[model samples]
Target: MNWFKPPVKSLLKLDLQHFGGSTLFELKQNMATLGQQLQKYEGELSQKAIDPSATLEDIKALQKSKEDIKARFDVIKEQHDVLEAEQKASFEDKSNIQNIADPKAKIVTAKAELIRATIRNQAVPKDVMAVLGDRNSTGGEKLLPTTMSEELLMEPLVKNPLRDISTYTNLRNLEIPKISFTLDDDDFIADTETAKELKVTGDVVKFTRNKFKVFAPVSETVLRGSNVNLVQSVDRALESGLAAKEKKVAFTKTPKTGEEHMSFYQTGETAIKTVNGADIYEAIVNALADLHEDYRENAKIVMNYADYTKVVKFLNNGNSTYFAAPPESVWGKTVKFVDAATDPIVGDFAYSHFNYDLDVLYERDKNVRTGIEDFVLTAYVDHQIKLKSAFRIAKVIPAV
Candidate 1:
């Protein structure tokens, strides 16, 4: 139960004053050597310039050699700079450790002294105190009087009041998970009720995954009826199962497997209006950004949007547009959207996500017809840590 007994010596037992001393000295020495090499090269180049007998080729060769040396020297210089920076950091850390004052040691010592004082006072005889003369002049009676002076009793003996360093040490070393931040571009968007009612033509949104398929709005079924009731066909797009297309593809439908829906233009909700290989990238970026900002500060998320067009075209045959919904083959991953209390910004635009790759773009512009958009997002955490501290100070002696 006794967790602590003050060490006879100071808290800093480790000899860290020389912690990075040798390494730093060596790094500085190496840097000085590199500098000297550069100076020597410069001197050699200058001396060669004074040789009138030197042919143009000889001069050119010397210049080339000097340039090569300078390039190599520059690399060494960069290395030196990096090493020096590390050395400086290490030095600062050692300095911090050396100057550390432990608060825990002081607190423990205070408690122990108080306990010892109480025990010593309790052992004194109460009868002896009652028999004492001069009640005014007699100092406050000890619970059990000892031969020691009243002055010594009045002032409790305290050893190294500032000795407690454990609390301070722990505070200085406190660490938490490290976090980084980035943006993903792909984002999902929903359509307005009015747009759905109008039967507006648009791109068929598509997405893929490693296994299994999720046809969003899979509930949104598409049925064939008279052209007069294209509204019915559009309504079917909201449901899952078969859909008949003959009345011209509204949202350029790739008719691929997995989740397929109409791509509508929504600002932050979705990055692309059309679902295709082109839009797949944007959707992915948006999805990543959402997940990144929401859960992990800086998480490494890997993703590749399923080539719905390739698979869809393969399944649907010659026609790019069809009424059929995607099968499980062409699938996409699902990432829950977590909105920030306040949205994040990147570049000039305030976006919830950021895309690492620029090549991923909208599919509509690339395709001869209105393009298909892709919606997909996948993510996982790589690593992280954090360092932090706090402090509190109290004066045990109250001011009179």
Candidate 2:
């Protein structure tokens, strides 16, 4: 018996209107899924054609299924195109702006134009040139809006604890001169210039272009209601996504190429993989004491909540009031709570420096080949180990 098919319009019309806010995000997903269905069905028809035992009816059934899915896919694709046009219209809608000449609004408008141009492969709005600044200055790169860039820097503090404690800089292709190691003090007169060969070794920390890209798939429906707010929403979403990624990059040691970030600027030598002690508390105290005298004063123990809880549970086991836990500092050093840490980081985090430029490069002019295209949020970032001896991993090894 042949399976009967219903009209595609009646079945799929309500789906677009009611699909989880019907944002371009969902529409694209819906279309991609249907596209795969059509492809798989076509493959089935090919297999059946070569099968001697397969009836013509078998091929017809598969072909009908493929056509049904394609028809539905076309509807959503059309909706996606209509929504993109509407978003472009919003970018062109000057009447919505109370003052077209307002500086902030103009910047917002220019950025919207750029985003729309990226989506549709259209010419960037002529007026955007004024706000875009000199593309030649940073080697064909444009800066992100100042406020938005600052927000990216600040968001890490709110979401990433390690980001808060480490030092920060903004200079591209930057070479920061820092003291890598110290020389012993000479027994000479305080005011006299002695010939003690200025032996403090130094090194340069060079900044490399670090690209942090976030793939934002605008919801088809969300863009439908867009005005100037479209840019704001997209930029904010990028900001949030970048900050979250930064958080991961900060804690992960030696992350892969794209995910490269500051992992406390410590080397294997500085990271304390083992501790000499009889108990958990004693081991931590010994580790802190083992840190170089130069760093001991400013050093703090950075432990994520999980590690901190383990320490508290072990130390407070004796819960004897006479020798209670300090409750704030660990052995006179401050305890900083950081997330995404497997083991506590012990160090003068100030010695771990991260440098990134404010000039952002967006890779536009590329077609949106898939349902979503990645927006590259790029900056030249580098990390410096002012003094390797300043950091140590707080890996606990209680007496067994």
TM-score of 2: 0.58
Which residue window of length 10 is worst by lDDT in model 1? Answer: 383-392
Highest-lDDT candidate: 2
Q: What is residue 323's positional error in candidate 1, in angstroms?
A: 65
Report the C-alpha lDDT of model 2 over 227-268, residue by residue, as the tens digit: 344664576667666656655666777677643435553344
TM per model?
A: 0.20, 0.58
| Tens-digit lDDT string for candidate 1 (100-135) | 133222222222222232323333223222222113
lDDT score for candidate 1 against the true structure: 0.27
lDDT of each: 0.27, 0.59
lDDT of 2: 0.59
Q: List the candidate 1 regions with Cα displacement exceeding 4 Å.
A: 1-22, 91-400
